[model samples]
Target: MLPVFTTPPPLGSGDEIAVVAPSRPIEESKLQRACDRLRETFSLDPVIFETATKDWEWLRDNPEARAEDIMRAFEDPAVRGVVAVTGGDDQLRVLKHLDPDRLTSSPTRFYGFSDNDNLRLFLWKHGIVSYGAVLHPTVTVDPELHPYTERYLRRAFFEESLGVVEPSPEWADEWFDFETGDPREWRENDGRTWRGEETVTGRVWGGCFSIVKWHLQTERYLPDPGDLDGAVLALETSEDVPLPREVRYTLRAMGERGLLGRFSGVVVGRPQTHSPGLEWNPGDDYREQLRDEICAALDEYNPDATAVFDVEFGHCSPIAPLPLGAKVTLDPTVRRIRFQ
Candidate 1:
């Protein structure tokens, strides 16, 4: 098993949460809107760090600047938590510049995902349970943020524990870019699907499969295989959706490394099966296809491990901010996921 990780205190009214862009730059307009909502809804303070507003080219060139902004947020006594404005491609570069001591010294709350998972995994390695990027998509959403997502954001931000995770009323099948344009195609939610029997309780590990695969290949960011024993494996696909073959290969590698059998359960987030310009959906054909590969992998490597799919997280519109390394009970029989 891995070392014990600290779960940061929840945010409260007047608490200051720092917004930083460690992976990519966020639009100033969107940041302003999110901050306004944070103040109005929760009566909390939202502070913007340097990288969140910096030009894209500059942030890309100086990975150290990104690291500095993250460490700055962590080290600040006034800051209660840190958030990634959005996600991008090259966050692996920023990881090298980070000093674990500076971050862990303060032990403040953190929330981010997608490419931001790189940093989340880093903090996880150092024994700090980091959160999902609730403020990322919640920042610039049009009309208003989805109620499903909003509810989880509230729980993650203000509550000590996110009690029971329920299925969203609706699911987003299509969407626009973060900068905003057009409405998201909302479809009726079908809820979660479970495979394997028995309730499994453990700390959740893993994030966007592509990023996890990257860590697997490098072998630098991942913990020792045996260290994940009895942990629940959290898996999901990003907007840049990978085909089933890719999923097969990655899981095969995990199985070969003796990593697949370590998990007592698996929580697979909803995949972005349909993205603008890369439309490849013929009524859940691709979704089922991707799911099949994942099941195949689990069957081969971890036949007894319980896994639930399409649980509204990761790239999906309605997301639950699963705290990496935090204890959770995944009860397949009751269809309830409770976080502590």
Candidate 2:
């Protein structure tokens, strides 16, 4: 049997949440603005950890300190939850220094994604459920938080269950330079569509696809393949915006390792097609190509598993918070997902 991870308690008004830099160092100005927003909007106190605003050189050199900040936040009695300043490229370096026992013993609510997926999966390996969406520098720093993002964030933090998952009426693929004061932008969302079997339910697993690939390379952090049996694999590409062929190659690698066939279902987040170097916006056709490529890979590896596409998570704006290690019901017939 897979070990049952304990769900951390929900947050409430007046609670203190620690802000830590488990990946890249945070900008002092951005951190202050986010902290102020947290205080004003949620009536909660934001306690910034020392490492959150440390110099990039110090942060890069001291992976142990980053690991320690996470440990201390979980161990701290005053902290009700923990949130990351932002996600970065090298969080895997911090994993070797973390104590699994300490994390399991305290199991505090953690919110982050992208590179922080390392910590999310680490918490999962230790039987602790953690939230996987939104970060201080990204979603929280917005002049006005998207209503869809705010709604799900509230449910993930304050409520016992996220009753239903739905796509936002609109979404944003373009990232702004918050440091340089670029204005936020959004485009109309047509809606989400699914493929594969009509319905399937299982415990959730997965994070940023690139990070998961990194975990496989290290041969650490991931749970045994047996532990993931019958899981609903949730995957999303990052800002790097890997090509369709690259995505297929990565999934094919997982299939070769006997990982793909173990899951009963798959939920892939909407692909971020456009980035700084990419000339064209990733419009409908590009998304369709991504879906086809992913489905083709899944067909070759895990034909029996159901799959859903364009989920409102990962590198997209107004993403939903998925609790790692929790059960979720995916119904393609009705095009609905409900978190238990």
Worst 10 residues of 2 by lDDT: 133-142
Model 2 residue 47 distance off true place after TM-score fit, in angstroms = 0.6
Q: What is the TM-score of each candidate against the true structure?
A: 0.95, 0.95
Model 1: lDDT equals 0.84
Candidate lDDT values, in order? 0.84, 0.83
Error in Å for residue 173 of model 2: 1.3
Off by over 4 Å in 1: 176-183, 279-283
CA deviation > 4 Å runs, candidate 2: 177-183, 278-284
The best candidate in terms of lDDT: 1
Per-residue alpha-carbon lDDT of candidate 2 for residues 214-306, written as tens digits (9 for 90 to 100): 988887777988998889998898878777778888889999999988999999898776688765456558778888888988899989888
